[model samples]
Target: MSDLARPRRSVLYMPGAKARALEKARGLPADSLILDLEDAVGPTEKEAARELVVQTLKEGGFGLREVTVRVNGLDTEWGEADIRAIAAMGPDAIVVPKVNAPADLHAVERLMDDAGAPAATKIWAMMETPIGILNAREIAAATPRLACFVMGTNDLVKELGALHTEGRAEVMTSLGWCLLAARAHGLAILDGVYNAYQDEAGNRAACRLGREMGFDGKTLIHPAQLDIANAEFGPSEADVELAKRQVAAFEETRAKGEAVAVVDGKIVENLHVETAKKLIAQAEAIAKMQAG
Candidate 1:
């Protein structure tokens, strides 16, 4: 995917074992759909889930949203089979849970190779456990195939013995560390899902908080959360206007052979110009989608 093209602001997780949810997800407004074969599917249901996911991809009518499969961890009995199945289906990405080191990624890479998966089948890592947080940078920097980090806050909370406070203070350090690693490696990072699927107010608050914390988007549990997540992550009208003004001001300065420009009493530099351009581009993309 192009770095310039913003991904689906809300990535909905559909239980791979549930064919109905998988089919329903195709009509949701979520930017991406994650067919989960991990925590969502029990051991007995894993094989069934894999088959359903593979069939869904083969059927191929998911609209503009990207598709991904969250395979069981490599340590699990079904992990290898999940990888092989996913490779055959050729979804946009494969999400690996609880990745602790570069070696974990290397193992998955080899599995993908053996399956003859296309190079475009990227890998997304879950930064959840304490060890995963500690080695987040090393794992993110491990290979070019690493595309993104999906925060697994529930696991992190369990590992840290943390209570769910309003601001999530207990897990702030790990979240920050994960963001740092993702940005350092130029990878997209998503905030974890909010467990209360029907709590609209809480989900909106969490989405806003994730945006403030520099997450590219938020993983979602239900389609009800899609609107809020997309709104929070996407550029606002005010943001687009400011970006346009900044670009105009900067361009005028450049034409005058000046390297810097003052906008609304604030000095704007090249960095500001770059940010404005990105904002405008994102706004345009969103507008096009809305128009369609």
Candidate 2:
């Protein structure tokens, strides 16, 4: 599958400080795994977690799951070492925290290059700070190696001094801005984590909202949230059937010198056909990944 279309429906953050969590992550149903070394690891365990994450990357039993490591911000004491070590090991990408501008990505790219990281190793920016949201476009277009955006809504709420209300009104603008930037640059973007992991109804509602908002997927805190995200983001059986019918109808109409077709009493234009094709492709990619 193309990097842009890779199924990231459920990206789970595994605490790098916990050896058992690292081991258990291998069999998790998440489409992507973020071996987190930033907020997930306490200050005292930073170095130890870094070492463990590096070793885990080297060991390599993650099957077809997209593996990434969330490194500390470059402003932090451990950020430089974290990037250098992670870049060399070369997970799918290095998740950089608190990216406030293009220059932040430039700095991370330089460190990655300096460490001789592979070309396939990309950067996932955490879009959390107010400055980051304000400069979302510039940051999205910052580097060719930057492949995805992961929303840091928890920190965003804290930064904005806003409460986490239902529907996430507090951080909606931030999310939308980063989303526009990500889509404008043709990069994949994931929604922020849902804090109330145990609340299945709330979690499902949040997942639905994220999918409706055009997120490729959502960052999750626990394995229990994986199925919710995957079901919400991945094309369902009904969706696949409708996409197939739409594509077939559109092709038939086009062959007859027509510009559009009707599907379930709604006009399906070229743009709709395009979206249907993409959905079909994404569904196929997800199936292939799971089958493998």
Candidate 3:
């Protein structure tokens, strides 16, 4: 969807140590699940969580799900072992925390290769630090194996000493730059989690804003936010209908030796047609994903 490998409209973070939560995630409607071993797991429980996450990936029951493990950083006590274990038991990707530079990605790539991980083991960078956001473009262009950019807004906010407002005014500039970098290199970018799990309306508004800002999806903290995130990020019925009409009109005009067409009094050009086609394709992809 949206030229991304999958529709990440609702990416939920499931605790790596919690068996019940991981089991519950299989039934949730989220597009992807991040089996988090970094922030979610306590220091003492890291080893157990790491082992459990690997076992879950090996067991593999979450159908049509892009399962990934959010590994601890290489700087941590359990980081290297976590990466080695996860690399061996590859999921869809291995999400590393606090990736600040291209060198960081290169280091992980070397580790993954050394571990003899499968070819499909992707690398997802958590853009949380100030340096990461500053070097967003370099980090994105660092490796072909990098697949997605997950906004770690909580850490960023803490780093910047900024408040997480209802509209996310403070972090908009950083988000914009990071998004530009991701798009420049053709990688999917996901908005960070909405901390207000109890506030459904707020979460819905945030998801809408994320979609408008051109994020491929939004990371979620709870199952309750799944529906709202999916709906808000998805193409509306009206949008799909309009895209179809525009594409039809453009094709007809092209056949008549025209460079542009007018659909419903709006000028439709090649760029518009391209956008329309992507929307249509994404809608179809989402429908197929849901049906299965």
Name the candidate that leads on TM-score. 2
- By lDDT, the best candidate is 2
Relative to the true structure, candidate 2 reaches a TM of 0.98
Tens-digit lDDT track for model 3 on 1-292?
Answer: 3237478899999999999999888888888999999999999999999999988888888877788889999999998899889999978899989999999888888889989888888999999999999999999999988999999999999999999898799899889999999999999999999998989989989998999999999999988899999899888999999999999999999999999999989999999999999888878888887787
TM-score per prediction, in order, is 0.96, 0.98, 0.97
Q: Any runs in candidate 1 off by more than 4 Å, and if so which?
A: 1-4, 288-292
- Deviation of model 2 at 230, angstroms: 0.6
lDDT of 1 by residue, 1-292 (tens): 3742766578889999998898898788777788999999998898988998999989977866789999999898999999988987778889999999999999998999899889888899999999999999899899888899999999999999889887889888998999999998899999998999898899989999999999989999878889999999988899889889999999999999999999889999999999899888877766665544
Writing each residue's lDDT as its tens digit, candidate 2 over 93-153 gives 9999999999999999999999999999999999999999999999999999999999999
The TM-score between candidate 3 and the true structure equals: 0.97
RMSD in Å for candidate 3, one decimal? 1.4
Every candidate's CA RMSD: 1.5, 0.8, 1.4
Q: What is the lDDT of residue 136 in candidate 1?
A: 93
Error of 3 at 50 (Å): 1.0
> What is the alpha-carbon lDDT of model 2 when measured against the actual structure?
0.95
Error of 2 at 198 (Å): 0.6
